[model samples]
Target chain A: GAGVSQSPSNKVTEKGKDVELRCDPISGHTALYWYRQRLGQGLEFLIYFQGNSAPDKSGLPSDRFSAERTGESVSTLTIQRTQQEDSAVYLCASSFFRGVQETQYFGPGTRLLVL
Target chain B: DQQVKQNSPSLSVQEGRISILNCDYTNSMFDYFLWYKKYPAEGPTFLISISSIKDKNEDGRFTVFLNKSAKHLSLHIVPSQPGDSAVYFCAASARVFGNEKLTFGTGTRLTIIP
Candidate 1:
């Protein structure tokens, strides 16, 4: 079976520009999550989706950051008016519908550099 | 305040030796703990996990030990191999049920010298 995949392995954009990152979860995975990894830091939770229920946006840093997942397949994270501080690796993960304790499989991640 | 802490930024061990990585958390409500291994340019992969009910869990050469009283946990890799060299992260969640939040500690880079 194929693993989770992300597009645009590397993205370099000017500050204040908007960028969108995409994620494709593994087949049959019903839980998806997004996280940010800043340099020299641990993974920070961003957002999560479970099936058709309302997505968990509690971890989103600001209103400028938003994500939408269509059904249980793919998700897109959009950052509006990006700042230099937003530069980091964006990771997406998926797991079986067994709840938070279930093991999650991660994608390679998309590295965003705000110049 | 950082909920989870990995005081050691790095560790070095000789190949075929035992390697120990430690982590501590301030939140007493956490019930599940996990360890992840990551390489440069890649996302973290789940290594092993332990629930609050169990003090220790082992998988092949990897073992995770949890001390509830001390609010601490450690991952032990016996006979460390060069391929195990990477950043190891410790994470904890308050609940094992639905919609639980995971708090992660700063990773510890492990270097295995052959």
Candidate 2:
């Protein structure tokens, strides 16, 4: 079975530009998540979507960051007015459901560079 | 503050030897612990997990041991193989309603020598 997958493996954008990263979760998965990993750091939770419930936006670092998932399928993470601090690898993951013990399968991730 | 911490940034172990990675957490609310392995240009894959109810969980050559009192956990790989060389991340999650997000550590790079 195909695992979670992200598009545009790499992206380069100038400061103040906007970038959208896409994620395709595994089929039948009802839970999707977005995370960011900075250089020499760990993965930071960004946002989460479970089934049709309201998305968890608590992890979004700033107002410029947002995500949307339609009908438990594809999801897009948009970062408006990109900043050098936003340069990092954006990863997506999905699970069968939003359970405490459920395993999250991750994607290859999209590396974004802001200059 | 980092809820999960892998004190060691890197470790090197000889093939056929035991490899142990350590992690600590400040939040006692964490009831589940997991280990993930990742290779260059790849996403992390789940290795093993341990629940708070039990102290240790083993799968094949991977075993995870947790200490609720000390808020510490360790991953042990027996007879480590060269192919096991990669970055290992420690993650934890509390069973809070409507909050299933995992908190991850900075990760430790492991190098296995053959």
Candidate 3:
């Protein structure tokens, strides 16, 4: 089975431009997540989508960051007016469902560099 | 405040030796803990996990020990291999409304010298 996957392995953009990153979760996975990792830092939670329920956007750092997941499949994270601070690796993950012990499968992240 | 903390930024061990990595948490509500391994230019891969109900869980040469009272956990890899060299991340989560959002600690870069 194919694991979770993301597009545009590397993206370089102007600080004021907007960028959209895409993620394709594994088949049958109902739980998808977006995270950010800065240099020498840990993974920061961004947003999560669980099935058809309302997505959890509490982890989103600012109003400029937003995500949308259609049903239980693909998800897109859009950053408006990107800043240099937003440069980092954007990782995507998916699991069967949000359970007490569910394991998440990750993708090869998309590295975004804001100039 | 960081809910999960990996005090050590890096660790180096000789191949065939035991490697132990530690993690601490400030939130007692975290009922599940997990460890993940990541290589350069790649996303993290889930290694092992332990539930609050158990003190220890082992798989192959990997063992995760949790001390609920002290709010600490550790991952031990026996007979470490060069292939095991990577950044290890400790993550925790509190199940709220079936949520699986995780709080991760700054990763520990492990270098296995052969």
Candidate 4:
């Protein structure tokens, strides 16, 4: 892809329902990240994938939020038994390096509304 | 705790004037800082960045200044234009083992008046 891409730009789900959000990171980028942003709040780090594995899952709010990646490419974020608090924009980013000096390229983001 | 903070939630500036937005962080290990601009329903776009070694980095109309002593940073937009109206976020990262995660501020909404 030319840049990071996210599917289901806008989603509306009923409470207690499960929802899946997808992200396709930039090609050749070795690092992928997921973040959540609530209205008027900052982007909160969720998880990170280096290649096919995630070394930092400390940011996952709970066990209900789990993410998986396929060999440095596409990633999926799944939320089970969604609550109203899950309503927010989920953003994905990728970078050439998994180090601090690298600049990240972001995807358009998926806006999820859990009613 | 909110390590990075953007005190001002919103800012208004007249076209052609200079607009300044501020950010502060408490962590001393943060060696790099970045500013991202975001439009409605869109992801943030990198605007400018400054490394720990340099005090300032400029890219055309956008400039980022870092004050390590005060743990403070700022973004300046010269000759502000309507197109510059967007939410700006400040992010920081440290050069440590498995600490590549970026911590971001709440973001400041900049409104440019024509």
**All candidates: TM-score:** 0.96, 0.97, 0.97, 0.97
Q: Indicate the docking level reached by candidate 2.
A: high
**Candidate 3 pairs with clashing backbones:** none
In candidate 4, position B91 carries an lDDT of: 97
When 1 and 3 are scored with TM-score, the better candidate is 3
Task: Tell me how many clashing residue pairs each candidate has.
Answer: 0, 0, 0, 0
Give per-residue CA lDDT, model 3, range B31-81, as digits (tens).
Answer: 989999999999999999999999999999999999999999999999899
Clashing pairs in 2: none
Off by over 4 Å in 1: none
- Mark the 10 consecutive residues where model 3 chain B has the least summed lDDT: B93-102
Consecutive 10-residue window with the lowest summed lDDT within model 2 chain B: B93-102
lDDT of 3 by residue, A12-40 (tens): 99999999999999989988889999877
- Candidate 3's C-alpha runs over 4 A off are none
Model 4 per-residue lDDT tens digits across residues B1-114: 999999999999999999999999999989999999999989999888899999999999989999999999999999999999999999998877475678999999999999
Report the candidate with higher TM-score, 1 versus 2: 2
Roughly what TM-score does model 4 have, to 2 decimal places? Answer: 0.97
Candidate numbers sorted by DockQ from highest down: 3, 2, 4, 1
Q: Give a tens-digit lDDT track for model 1, residues A2-115.
A: 999998899999999999999999999888889999999999999988874545788899999999888778999999999999999999988886644777889999999999
Across residues B1-114, which tens digit of lDDT does each residue of candidate 2 receive? Answer: 999999999999999999999999999888888999999889899999898999999999999999899999999999899999999999988877466678999999999999
